[model samples]
Target: MTTFHDLRSRRRDLLDDLGELEDAFAEVTAALDEPSNDDEDARAEQRRHRAWLERQRAGLLVVLSETERALLEFGADGWDDP
Candidate 1:
């Protein structure tokens, strides 16, 4: 029995999560750009981490899109008490 309130809450949470992930992604990209004395193994680990973050970001974006669509479909008049 999901309500409009629930959808809105989920959307807000997703947006926050996306923002944090974006910041982390930027930091990782900057780290990758800079010259470091890290060993091959360490660099590889960083690349892997970046890739994982990218995948997570993509998934979150998809969920966020879906949530937005649901909100639109529900409309403002569809508010149901949680």
Candidate 2:
């Protein structure tokens, strides 16, 4: 029995994680775009890191979507219980 409070809390946590990941992704993208003296290895590592962040972001988005759907199903006055 998932409560409204539980869903809201999970949604908030997921949103926070997604926001942080987006920030990191932006930073990595900026680093990659800059004309630095990084070697091939360093560039590869940056790419890998960006890819990993993208994957994590995707997963969080999926979960967030599900959570939103569940919340919607709970109706507008759902928070009255919690």
Candidate 3:
């Protein structure tokens, strides 16, 4: 019941979401790098946040890979069927 348009749209949306996540990760990394905020407690909090962001980024990457594989298989199956 899925069309090529649907697959493409889904892929685009996922890619956009991935981009946003990467941007956020970069911002968090930059904030962590600032030497002025040298408070130990603050640095610990930032490290925790960075870890969470890394986990989220990793999860998204896995999902994106799976989606790409699905799209490829869908195309191949469409061509091979009937």
Candidate 4:
């Protein structure tokens, strides 16, 4: 039974982490495919970051789902976007 503010804060943080992780993954891939690659550290780092991103994304999805459920319980109060 978390408040909307708490859920929103966590969701925002999680989304930001996912964005950073995605950037890291993309950077690693680009470097790995380059002809003059000098960084071998990114392979492992990419794997780790990708895993972390997946976990965070899943958790955030759950939090959003729960938030929607709570909102539903409060009754539909004209949610249609005008």
Candidate 5:
């Protein structure tokens, strides 16, 4: 069984990781929005990267959601103000 402190730490880490992922996702999206060459291969590669990033972001979101729910159930343990 994980301690409340451990869960709090995990939640903080997950939130930080999610923020970084979101930043990266935004950058990739911006790159995709820019005009590019007509080469189908290059376009396909960019699309693949975008898709992969989207999947990563989705997975991180799910984990973050789970972590938050667990933390909520565990209570704030005086770590937070009511």
Candidate 6:
């Protein structure tokens, strides 16, 4: 019995997480392009962050689907079953 507002809030949180991860990735890219490959540890850290982002991305998809369903259900006029 989740409400529309609840689903919207959850979707917002997921989008916020995605934006934060994108910013973190920019930092990783900056570190990687330092004109030297002497930071294997940094590269490894970047890989880990990217993997985490991938998992988050997948999770966002599910949230998006849920939000879409909620919107549709709430907006469907005369959806009451006979």
> Of the candidates shown, which would achieve the greatest TM-score relative to the real structure?
2
| Ranked by lDDT, top first | 2, 1, 3, 5, 6, 4
Pairs of residues clashing in candidate 2: none
lDDT of each: 0.87, 0.91, 0.77, 0.61, 0.77, 0.70
Q: What are the per-residue Cα lDDT tens digits for candidate 5 across 2-62?
A: 7767767877887788788788878877877889765888778878887887888799889
List the candidates' TM-scores in order.
0.88, 0.90, 0.77, 0.53, 0.79, 0.65
Q: Candidate 6, which ten residues in sequence have the lowest lDDT sum?
A: 73-82
| Model 3 stretches astray by more than 4 angstroms | 1-3, 76-82
- Which parts of model 5 are misplaced by more than 4 Å? 76-82
- State residue 46's C-alpha deviation in candidate 1, in Å: 0.5
Query: What are the per-residue Cα lDDT tens digits for candidate 3 across 1-82?
Result: 8666566677777788888888888998999877764779888888898898889889888877876677787666553222
lDDT of 2 by residue, 1-82 (tens): 9987899999888888999999999999999999999899999999999999999999999999999889888896753233
Better of 3 and 4 by lDDT: 3
Where model 1 places Cα greater than 4 Å from the true spot, the runs are: 76-82
List model 4 lDDT by residue over 5-59, tens digit each. Answer: 5545655665666677577657756665666544556566765766776676677
Lowest summed lDDT across 10 adjacent residues in model 4 is found at 73-82
The count of backbone overlaps in candidate 4 is: 0
Clashing pairs in 3: none
For model 2, the stretches where C-alpha displacement exceeds 4 angstroms are 77-82
Clashing pairs in 1: none
Q: How many steric overlaps are in each model, in order?
A: 0, 0, 0, 0, 0, 0
Indicate the worst ten consecutive residues by lDDT in candidate 5.
73-82
Ranking by TM-score: 2, 1, 5, 3, 6, 4
Instruction: Kindly indicate the candidate among 2 and 4 with the higher TM-score.
Output: 2
User: Which model scores highest in lDDT?
Assistant: 2
